[model samples]
Target: MTRSWRPWIAGATGLALVAGAGVIWSVRGSDPGSGCERTTITIAASLDHAPVLQTIADGWLRTDPRVDGRCPDIRIVAARSADVAANLGDARAAGGSAAPSISPTAPLSPSESAAAAASAVSDASRRPTVWAPDSRAWAGLAGTRPEAASLLAPGAPSVALTPIVMATTPDRAGALEGRITWPDVLRQIATGRAPLVLGTTDPTASTAALLTLMSLADTDGDGKPTAAEIAGPLALERTARVYAGSVDVLAAQMSPGDSAGSAPGARVSLFPATEQEVLRLSASGDAPPLVPLYPAEGVAPADHPYYVLNAGWVSARQRAVATAFLDVVLGTAGRTAYAAAGFRDRDGTLAGLTSASGALDAAYRGRPLPGTAALTEVLVRWRALRRPANVIAAVDTSGSMTEKVPGLPISKLAAFRQAGIQAVRLFNDRSRLGLWEFSSDLSGSRDYRVVVPVRTMADQVGPVSQRETIIAATNRLRPHSATGLYDTIDAAYRAVQGIWRADQQNILVVMTDGRNEDEDGFGLDELLGRLRAAKNPAKPVTVLAIAYGSGADVQALQRVTEVTGGRTFVSRDPADIGAVLLSAMVNR
Candidate 1:
């Protein structure tokens, strides 16, 4: 059992400065010698504790803190915990080292050199010396990286604890004052009995959001879930309804407190947040004081593990500095800072909590996070079970695609076919996907024609897997005419808008290789006007465009997608277009 220390109250200044700013940027300690002689360590941590960490580092620096025999400088950068894990995962996948630099002496094209340099710089920025993500849940997701075993030192201690809770107004919470479990909440959401619209942070970008989904996955209280449990139909249906975009969106809709009276536009009912976040919300007083309900079944508290990266970039002196930093975090002053930030002690006990919040006992220590493989299975199941989608894949089969790609044996059209075939596999069986080919004189008068009608992958009218049909159709795609870009985009967007399903994400995927060449079709300006006129935020439809090869009109395509809150991917080389297309599909 962990011991509870004296309740130490922090000054109001700590609350105002620490929680208010999402990120804390600072350099601590006196300047070290120039170049290699100087040792500077960078630590990227969760946004919530950046301020608390900054305070600790600043104080230590003023006292000339040192590790081993050398005094060092420390810098802290605040970022989302999921983002940190992803960065490390990326570096780990790339041979557990920073991206290799382009050889200056080797002969290379300007574009090739630029691409290599850009990739290297991006990888370097993400590889920090130390990482303190919000919870160990990331361990399962990130442990697959090549350096995962070494990234987190053995016997690492958690600096603080904050249980994930459902935040709602005090009055709403009072009606059901007893214990609540994740299953109960899921039931409420599924049946429309939920008092407020249940929402959370983006699972792909937030650790809390990911944990919320995992908890929901194993409603039977079976510790970690098996593959069958994760892949079951009931779990998929339940999880699909729980996701409500990112937590920030829900936070925006919140009004300060109960007294404000629900405003005209404000409408979030309940949000999944850390206990610290719940306390922070209550302290703001701008919204109604929220009641934090610790689910009775179990909880997954963010333990905030301090990880030291085991990379070659980290020097001996830098490792020593990292050790010193961890000491300060687990020490007396660090405990006090954590209390001020509305966190529980390592044992899940409330120590020196100055801020007011709903009553919570110290007994709510959550279950141990699932093993690496179990967590991976949960994530994989989510991808297959997420909300179904409706996509109209518009491919430009203009004559330019007939030209052979320089480095490969296939033509541009063949590469796009392969890309389309692969990308379709990423979607769930419930998703409806259709294919269309566009070029001047696609028909007697029309510039585009639907080759495959949009239908769910499970539809019995076609092959057993609708995805395979789409891939097979790609084989028949042939380049023969001039590009009819503008008219095709307008037609597809309007067509989808008329039948947009509220339950599914409606999207228009445009793969083109050349500028508009239609002599009689609608112009770019006319198409943009139609899109703007038909725009409805409530029934949003995104247009994802892929400009394949050097001849594509990327700038023009960007304008069309930007108006719909979508993005355009440019692939100057057709050989690599498959990867870019796949990325666009997954991110969307």
Candidate 2:
């Protein structure tokens, strides 16, 4: 319920400067070293609190803030929470004790998002001494790895507060007043009743997205996710497009110029965002306003936790300065800065932006932060059970595929080969995959050859991952012999059944450029009977067939997939194969 968000202007001159200037430049104020040694201390503040943090730090530094009589250069950096997490997560996994070399901080990649702070901020090659993410959700996520529990100093107090809310167009907010929830929204998406495309940031990087990801995964309220819970999202939400670090830019992306599916000038989207985000962006008056929608089931609130790094790179002097910095945040100076920015104080006290919460501004109360042990428990469960997919694809390698797609530069097989490589990237490491290439007499009398054995993407095939193995095999494909479609699909169906796990989504997809060419091959009627007969009511194998180019039999492929409770897709133009393949991959 509480996660402070992107792009709400607070009262500080620094906040206004950043919001208007499209930058977060490092400031080395007039010589802090009148007669003392000079040192630079960088504070990696989450985008939600960067401006306020900078303002407060500047005020505290004016008092000649120092460590061991060393005058310090207070540098406040606006780092997206997700970018910092990946860097810190990597360091924790590597067990690196040394501090990262102090490289000059990089600006946000996109010129505009520097204000939105939409790009990843931390360079993967470096580390910082302090991290102030907008929520304990980050702390919980980072702490999932065992060493991270001890690697980051704990109990950093909250400096500001915000609640997560479902933001929608002003017109829709009334009808959905109290009935919406994460489960309800996700069910609509999976069931295809969802009215608009949902927007989200990468869960690993954004606290708001992490909270939403865990919520979307925990439909049964078990506090842990199952593959069944993950399957729908894995298939349906696949096209939602995970942005690098911007909830502020989500609705804007709804315009056709930014992403797919939406009609031109159709600027509208739905997402779980912070109250301050809805308020701040609405206050801007340039774009159409978004109304806040509270879920029937509660949301987790975000508290801006100020963290001082516990790695070897944090010297005692840096730690001392960090402690002093923490003191200012916990004191009146920080509270005043946050209040002016339309954020709640640590105690849930609000000021300056009541109307900024948009339509549902009445009596908004932030939920309490969970204790450390409970936070750790939830994150552990999440880490153990992120969504996993089980998909096996059968690619047609018949000689007819060698014919060039009409009006296209590549052959039917070449287009699909490239599509196969792109599709493999849609699945995470937890998912299992396998591949087969089919044509007549590929191996002895068999119509198909098992090119890459079905295995989890995490597995190493000699020196590369199973995913790489699948890609390499696809790259090496050459159309040969006649299409042996029917029998090969049946073989892959049986393969999925043999390895089917009750917890995972079990699917088998067949890609072909032409109809069965083998005279000895089983007829379509015979193949459909075998598939229907082999079907397990409990462990179903969904079969999807894609017909590439106009030469392939669409009706036959449809009949084939229909028997196994799946549908077929057509890419009559090889140019459309990528979109069609993606549609096939995530189609339920």
Candidate 3:
């Protein structure tokens, strides 16, 4: 099938099945492979494979006699584990009337990862016959499957499981007397009593990383770390680092006996089971001495599960292979393999598992991590906490900005003036808006004067005055001097800094169509550094940037936003300026 049709089919099927009974089932007819004819089946494995899974794969192929001549050919497609959900989605869209399949070569993009899991149950063409994810938490994404309750016959085997553990340096573990609690760990990092270093796979992309964060949030009794919490004294005690991209990169950087001055160095520790496997390598002399820390507050294990796609496209032969494979993986041998990989074999012992394992088992099977929902709620709350923002609109009114479009008679300056007027009109009354146009020299010679300070102006009063002021400022802004975008933004930040309140959010909305050419008491880097360090220290301020036309250092604006958790929008169309500014204000 064509690539275009694939995603459409997957998305449609997953949505249909999930919205309906949650459990998707394809009618079974006479099995195509009933006579014991062999067929090839592809397995899409996630990137993070626990040791137990590898062991099971090795043992299963060797022991299964049917595989020698009679059974289906099992072709393994080693793709990034995160892509499995998306692949399953595509399979579902293709319709399960026939056995589901996927293009092994296809990989998900960054944005695609967000919808991958959901699309699996919702998409039609991308569904896979079977999906072995690193955590059962993913099952929730499939929606409620009541049919799953009745699908199991008298003696059905269970899915997969993997235990999560913390990996730390032996010296670090010794400081805590072998075991540690989450609170104590946080305290040590906060108090500088112990040099705390922890690593995890990327939370945005890795299921393991997400689960680990969820577990920590549960332990903290907060959904997730607040911006304030992340910026707290603890993070400053040492450099709180985020090893984005891959765990292997972090592992390689932190592996002992390697260079001590590398990015994270070998002293860094990792949390969760995947890292524990790395620790095992150290124990075996393949790496350095890495200790596993079982937090005293309790430990949580990852519940890895293998799910079957019940879309309409699943053919008789594929269904048979899927069933047979599930049986092989979840059966006695499968459970043993999981146990060998540090996971508790609780296939037939859920009640006993919880009763005996206590907190660890609770973490594995609990209904959403305790603080996850709350943490997410808090994060959202914090998003708008500093609701009414105080922004200074620093516009570059350089001579180049007056250059007419190659064919158009209207100069860029006229377009900017119109855009600035529209932007001022769109300003929220709750927001204290000001206008400052600068070129080689400050247009009005008022270096840092408030055009409109913080106050809820009536519909016609404040906004009208602000618009008039902006228009007058633009009219008087002669295109005689060079652009000092950096200097203007710096002065605006300082001006706004004087009126910034702890409870209110302060923002510097800078619109520049050119680079910093003139006025330079302080360089761009120094000015940005001052802004970064200029936060009230009690309340944080964010900087939003809008790049218009061309050659306007977009990267510089993005850097400012990244450090402040703000955002940057680029637009060549002058009309879009107002909407972009409004979006930044609302988002801030």
Candidate 4:
């Protein structure tokens, strides 16, 4: 994702409040009796809950007498939660001198209205007057601030608290005693003892999904589940049953007798929950009842909190309005709304709701919460467990790559040179990185040069310093060698096999801009056989192929990636080469 920031210039000479030597700039104004006038408040919310928040905003504006005559038009600007904080930062920065002050945003999207309120507290200059998130944890993350205050006390009044329940069919729950544990679930799926159905939203895009994974890691007695934990023998064997996407999408896939035309027995039976809220929303009077299973292990609550930024340009009247809105949201009425949404009351009590009986064992309540540090460690460890990757960065020193494109005087070869410099820098730091160049037979063949051997280095070095060395080497190549694409990949693979790391994740990232025509004995079939044989019983190596320019073979490169379990990207613009390579590395 590209990082974006908006720049705004502020107007000159606003009243400055210098209380206790702290600079506070306020734009003086009054609530002019312009009642019922349409105004817009831009809201950045998670996509999953944007629909619900929109519903509430429309309902509140139409039905509430207090808001009927006084409410301003609310305009929501929805985006991923991860993008909210950065976008808010841009908006705040843009309001400098030439623009009006506004509210601050959070790094993560809010899970509940209370969390949105808390995040608003940090927006001293650009305080959002209203906020509605999906969970209470957002409130905790948002905390209290000097310019903004918590609308709800910590655990005082909850907008909603839902239990993380397991969604399985009545039949599947029968053999498992209705109660389930992470180990039991994994065992059943691994051994093929039970037809298990597991679904999770993309953790990258959803905070609630990530929390569920964290809860599972905690239940496993493993603080964090590494990629290896997820891709291990057990997980790999269960891959046929795993689904990653939105909750609604998973629900549709699990609906019984609802499969359009797949196998007769294909049905999803397990799901994560937010307690009563999900159950009520998922209920259909005509469909099979969606049952809930509380895992024997303790559950983790989604604590969404609101945050606000305090700057020097907030107007006093706006501040008062924001404060009023905050108070109203944390009051009894807001907490009641929270409970109605299937959230636990602020006290962490389940209220009068009974446990799912046999669905969860009493002994499971004491399981410890998963730590963030532990999860990070697991990711790192899993990365280490992956077979070491083998990469050959094939460059084009052909006359075309050396020609300059319009606007930019820099030749395509120069761009490739710079990308090579970057690739080397990345390879030097991680895995086994190497370099190769191909052109016409006039320049003859160049063997792979070991730029950074994975086994030789202990502490990885950053690539900035090595730019001059790579540039100097690249500049020496004449644009006359044959573009022996197959030969080079064959050479690189052979080189990779010679220096094998049994447990490492073997990979090849090939960068080329032309077709393959060579004299080397390596054919497509032989190369593939070598690639497959390298992994044996375990799937190890991966090849990420990048084809630049119109002459590149997109299909052949895609086939290579498919066979190797890697990805392929075709870049029409050479400038994008560096970024594409970087993405492949991070993902690897």
Best by TM-score: 1
| Whole-structure CA lDDT of model 3 | 0.49
Best model number under lDDT: 1
91 Cα displacement, candidate 4 (Å): 6.4
Give the Cα-based TM-score of candidate 3 against the true structure: 0.47
Cα lDDT tens digits for candidate 2, 1-588? 011223322112111112332224344433533566755566667877888887776777677666777765555667666444433433344455322211011122335234333222333212355778888766665565544555566677787887778876765454342367766665665455654556665454556665665555555655544434544344324535334356777756543223224455434466778777777767766445777776656556678888887765567887787787788887888888887776776766565446644465446553344444444333333432344667778888888888887788888888888777877866777789888889999999989988888899989999999989999999999988888888898888999899998777788889887898777878988888888889999898888888878888999999987788899999888777887886666443
In model 1, how large is the Cα lDDT of residue 347? 76
Better of 3 and 4 by TM-score: 3
Count of clashes, each model: 9, 13, 44, 67
A best-first ranking of the candidates according to their TM-score comes to 1, 2, 3, 4
Q: Would you estimate the TM-scores of all the predictions?
A: 0.57, 0.54, 0.47, 0.47
Model 1: pairs clashing at backbone N, Cα or C within 3 Å: 196-269, 201-247, 255-287, 256-286, 256-287, 256-288, 257-287, 257-288, 258-288
Q: Residue 569 of model 4: what lDDT?
A: 82
Q: Which lDDT values do the candidates have, in the order given?
A: 0.68, 0.65, 0.49, 0.46
- Residue-wise C-alpha lDDT for candidate 3, range 132-164, written one tens digit per residue: 556544333222222222121222223544444
User: Which residue segments of model 4 deviate by more than 4 Å?
Assistant: 1-88, 91-158, 177-179, 218-244, 257-266, 284-287, 309-319, 352-587
